[model samples]
Target chain A: MNADAVPLLEARGMTMRFGGVTAVNNVDFVLGEVELRCLIGPNGAGKSTFFKMLTGQLTPTAGTVRFRGEDITGAYPHQVARRGVGIKTQVPNVFDGLTVRENVFVAAARLHQARTARRIADETIEHVGLTRIAGRMVGQLAHGQRQWVEIAAVLAQEPDLLLLDEPAAGMNKEEVARTSELIREINKTKALIVVEHDMQFIRMIAKTVTVFNQGSILIEDDVHTVLSNQSVRDVYLGRQAA
Target chain B: MAGAIASGWASFAAMLLAGLVLMFGLPHVFDLFGLLQMTVFVAMAVLALSQGFIWGYGGIMSFGQSAFFGLGGYTYAVAVMNLGDSTGAVALAIALPAAFAALLGYFMFYGRISDAYVGVVTLTVTVILFNVFNSTAGDWYTIGNAPLGGFNGMPSVPPLNIPGHPDEPLDPGQLWYAAMGSLILVYVLLRGVLASRFGRVVVAIRENETRAMLLGYDPRLYKLLTFTLGGGIAGLAGCLFTNWGSFISPTAFSLAQSAQIIIFVLVGGLGTLLGPILGAVAIQYMVTLIGAQQKVDGNLIVGVVLIGFVLLVPQGVVPVVRNVLQRLFVRTPRGGTAPVASEARP
Candidate 1:
């Protein structure tokens, strides 16, 4: 990546205040052209709120979010997506009544022509290793399968950046491993902001790490440095370990 | 699931056969009164379809479908009275309600109102329309040569004359043919739309709006389109309804009318198009039977049956029956995997 190239995404002084309470206060964040960043923090630590702002689900009270030099602050979620940003929300927010293939088809049809979209949907489903169960309804599928379907749908959007919230939250061991591999593969061509609590999953894929606490970023550094930080352990990791 | 909804050749053939028997064979089997009643049921079935598509497919539970229905009847009455033609009046009947729906849907969906509010707002609109028309009594409320007719209604609404030959109106049997033909046309149109890409996207949005938005779909636009389509359909039904009864009245927009439409969709089934059609026929038949007797109130019986259906078969009859049919026909697993068979149907 060129040092002088514009960053893929940048946010400055992002603040979200709900009445008297500030969920996220004066947070500044940035991502390069192709990088995987892990956000680790305890519940209500502002990471989720910060993620929502980045995905255009919430407009911060004060601040600007820019993508590729274009201001996208307070833009509609679809507008953010059209600007080459894809998002997988915290919950399994896929079409539960649709088959896995149909869910992926909707995602692919957003940009491609009808015939092309069908081809792309089939190929993406195949690429995601969901061919065996592609015909199964998503609502009937296991939790892990639903997450994979959502991930595949995001992948089919073919975005330059992906904002994934807890992609592996309810997944089992093998599912987690597969998700880690998928994240790493995706990060090869796309920038990723993965807000996850599973340190094991993060260790498998994440390179740079950003830590948040009390509605602000505590630290941003290489994974090893952030993991070894005494303050991070005291505030976040210690709670999980205990 | 929207794309994969089963329309196998066998099912298609069966549906076609059923439609043909209703069109040609039914007139011979039933007496004139029964034939007229069948026509009425067909019109109401179309009304049930409007609710089914929006509520079942688009995930919108509108409470004032009768608003459009009444608007269609009024438009037909006013247009036919002014223009001295039925063809033109039919077009106006469909267009006015659809335009109104688009305007209303834009406000509700774009404003991001909650679902319950949508229901309330729609119901309120119907109530407002009911009051507006009910008070249009005397000669002062005339639109052109047509009297608003107040609570008396525009009785003896002119029957639809043959297009290009406005002097001769269609006899009852011919009108029956038109009504049956229309129901068949509407059923096919809705089926085709549901199989299209736009329909798939609407269903996807219905399943999860936020997720759909994140995937670059504007839920408001799709929802507005669905609502408009539904309104037009209901209007078409209303036009046919006025033709059937040879009357138009404020009662067309009453809350009771709207509630009856809802009950038809709910009792028939929510998602399946065929379910709503059957539901309208079944409920209307029961109501007709209850009407013949003097002791028990028809509404009371309807309420009890609705409650029973809700508790006993909440998913509606179509899904349950389909499941039963599937279970009864134990197909050998092909290649060790059961064919999904539109299992994810909306």
Candidate 2:
């Protein structure tokens, strides 16, 4: 909702360490409804680790995670997903043997209606423009098409909050543009927290950006303001900004 | 549509007819021991199917399906012995062991062990059970009136009782009929399950565990359910085994037996529902054909066959055969009625 209201997901003083290294440190973040936020960080910034903690794959060493006003710290990944939070990994994670429609149907099944699952699966596949190949095995699809199938699967979940770990990990300009449009579309109904390395893709979809460095939130601002900041460029964007 | 049903019935009738031909025809030509050996192979085929449910469809590779088989043997023996001479004893023998399998499967599966770990854990359990039963005969009069027969297993185990003919010991023909009935029942049940949502999820888990988990389907729960159901079926096979031979031996619990069943499942095609049966029959036929020629190690021959099958047709003979049959006899359906339609998109 807001800083004052209960955010869809709230991580307060979240810290995670792997032995001697602190992967994420005292990170306080909130994701609100219809909010599209991007987490931008340099390589080795622990963005993946931080995201893993949120999904309950790894427990935060210290912190409280509240999802939908309920404390959900250290919940199983599957259990956490049932609370209306769905995550799409950086790697495409579709059943290689299953058809696109089946993949979406599997995700839609979480909503608990056989008829609705099929209908939603069909709608999601069509919406994602995967209808043409909806009957093909995911393993047969091109890498970019496979990625859209993964997105289609997540959309079928009808998540209240969608956590996307780099939806454009490997894509050309056209695919990236299509993914940006898909992201924009998904953001209209659900809160989105996307971690991305592609600034162009991020700026195209994310209204606000959170920059992470050394496992902590370095700064949070509107996309335009963050991009134009001289200090932001000096520390992280000097080479890339050129 | 009629052709499909007719062909399905024809294949089934042909199998039964061939079995009858083997029963009446073979005995007319060969000896009793040969027919008995054939019966044993058929029983092994059923066991392979039971094991396939967990290992192939559910991704739980268990080396201890034989333990359920052994349990079924012992349970049937003990129940028949207790009942002294009733047909009801035969029913209880199969039912009790099947129940035990279900119970054991429930506990093993609900514990949330990894798939490979489940195999190891079950194998260990099987070994433990083997030793426990193998040693039970020593304390002859301690528990029951009769000894458990230990390593030698129980001999003179009561034969299955026919309802009105208590004095008649079931002949090879009757045993064949019973075995065939059981095989068909198992076939229909497993086929139905494999086509259902639960089967789809089991295969999905086999394809990708994490995706199934992240999508709200608990792989462990499904795995446990599958393992237990499979165990029960295997247990039924064991009950039949004990009844067929009128003896129980530790050989039923040996790793060799486990390996044989595993070979049957894998050499058949791991994931396909009917693959185990084909594998079972093929391997049994090979063993029979080869054993007829010389005194070679049966297990070693099975190993070579498994390796050869893996290299040539990784999907196993049943899948390969089905693929060929589909191409030859089936017409390509247009406008989304295709079999691979669901496999096209993801």
Highest-scoring model, TM-score: 1
DockQ of each: 0.56, 0.32
Model 1 Cα lDDT, one tens digit per residue, A1-242: 57799889889999999999999999998899988899989899998899889878999999999999899999999999988999888888898888788899889999988688878988888888898888777888888888889989998988999989999999989989988988888888999999999999989988899999999999999999999999999999998899
What residue runs in model 2 are displaced by over 4 Å at the alpha carbon? A1-4, B1-38, B84-113, B139-146, B162-170, B293-295, B324-346
Candidate 2: residue B127 lDDT (0-100) = 87
Error of 2 at B127 (Å): 2.5
lDDT of 1 by residue, B1-346 (tens): 2223443434656876899888999889998899899999999999999999999899898999999999998888888888887999999999999999999999999999999999999999999999999999998999889998888888888888898678989988888998898899888888767767787788898888988999999998999999999999999899999999999899999988999998888877787888889999999999999999999998999999889988998877877888788789855332223322222245
TM-scores of the models, in the given order? 0.96, 0.88
Q: lDDT, candidate 2, residue A146?
A: 84
Counting clashing residue pairs in each candidate, in order, gives: 0, 11
Off by over 4 Å in 1: B1-10, B330-346
TM-score of 1: 0.96
**Model 1, docking class:** medium
